[model samples]
Target: MNTTINMTGNWKPKLMIIGTLLGAGVGLVTASLLARAAEEGGDLELNGGDLLKTALGVVTTMRSVAALGAGIG
Candidate 1:
């Protein structure tokens, strides 16, 4: 009976941690930028169309990133 666990090829958790940190960093930067813009512009108003466009752009970017390395050897 083998009770030992293999530590090799365990990359998913590492990748997830890195991805989470990167996502948090990006969110912080985005929030900071928005705050600065709002402060300088007096008021920040986002219409429905603007929000929809931004959502679509983010989805497209995420899809593109997810497709990376799909065709690589």
Candidate 2:
């Protein structure tokens, strides 16, 4: 008599889902802020006021994503 068994991998689905969620969240926040700033009825000047806030937001997103990737690695 002989017997056979089969197995499937689930790592791809799990990682894909997590990555999608994280990316979407970060992208959403960044896009919304950028759009609002652009629509605030004013000339575009990213070198003065509001620059810090914009920088912080982008840096924060990068840091979080980096941390997550580091942890995964």
Candidate 3:
């Protein structure tokens, strides 16, 4: 009386896993790029207030993106 969709003999599950891995790979690459940009100091230097603003903006953007992905935005 098992009531589960048996995915053992399906290619769909494999494809889904591959898709997830690809998305994760892309995100990692993007993070690396952002780190490189920060390290190289590509013209984003700011003072106290400006630095706080920039930090807030980046954090807000990340949160918004996560929210949208979670369908909560």
Candidate 4:
């Protein structure tokens, strides 16, 4: 009798790099939009508060997604 098995190696580095780039791109776009919104709001200002809130929201969402993917959620 004979048996054979095949397995694929992980592509974690490439996946990590892609994830990092995607996160960075999201952060950059979010910051730009928040700044633009703050500027257009005139006297109704956030003084970085809006930006901080947006950043926290993004982080929280990412963390939740990661946890769900890892079966922790």
Best by TM-score: 1
Estimate, for each residue in 1-73, the C-alpha lDDT of model 4 and write its tens digit: 4433333566677768989999799879977887887789864455688779877987899899889666687
lDDT of 1 by residue, 1-73 (tens): 4344355897779878988999899889988999999999989988999889988988987788777634322
Question: Per TM-score, what order, best first?
Answer: 1, 4, 3, 2
Taken over the whole model, the C-alpha lDDT of each candidate is: 0.81, 0.74, 0.74, 0.76
- Which sequence of candidate numbers ranks them by lDDT, best first? 1, 4, 3, 2
* Alpha-carbon deviation at 49 in model 4, angstroms: 6.2
Residue 12 error, candidate 3, Å: 1.1
Task: Decide which is better by lDDT, 2 or 4.
Answer: 4
TM-score to true structure, per model? 0.77, 0.44, 0.45, 0.55
Q: Decide which is better by lDDT, 2 or 3.
A: 3
- Give the per-residue lDDT of model 3 (tens digit) for 1-73: 4344455777687868976898699779967887888889876444799769867986898799679656686
Clashing pairs in 4: none
Q: Model 1 residue 53 lDDT? A: 97
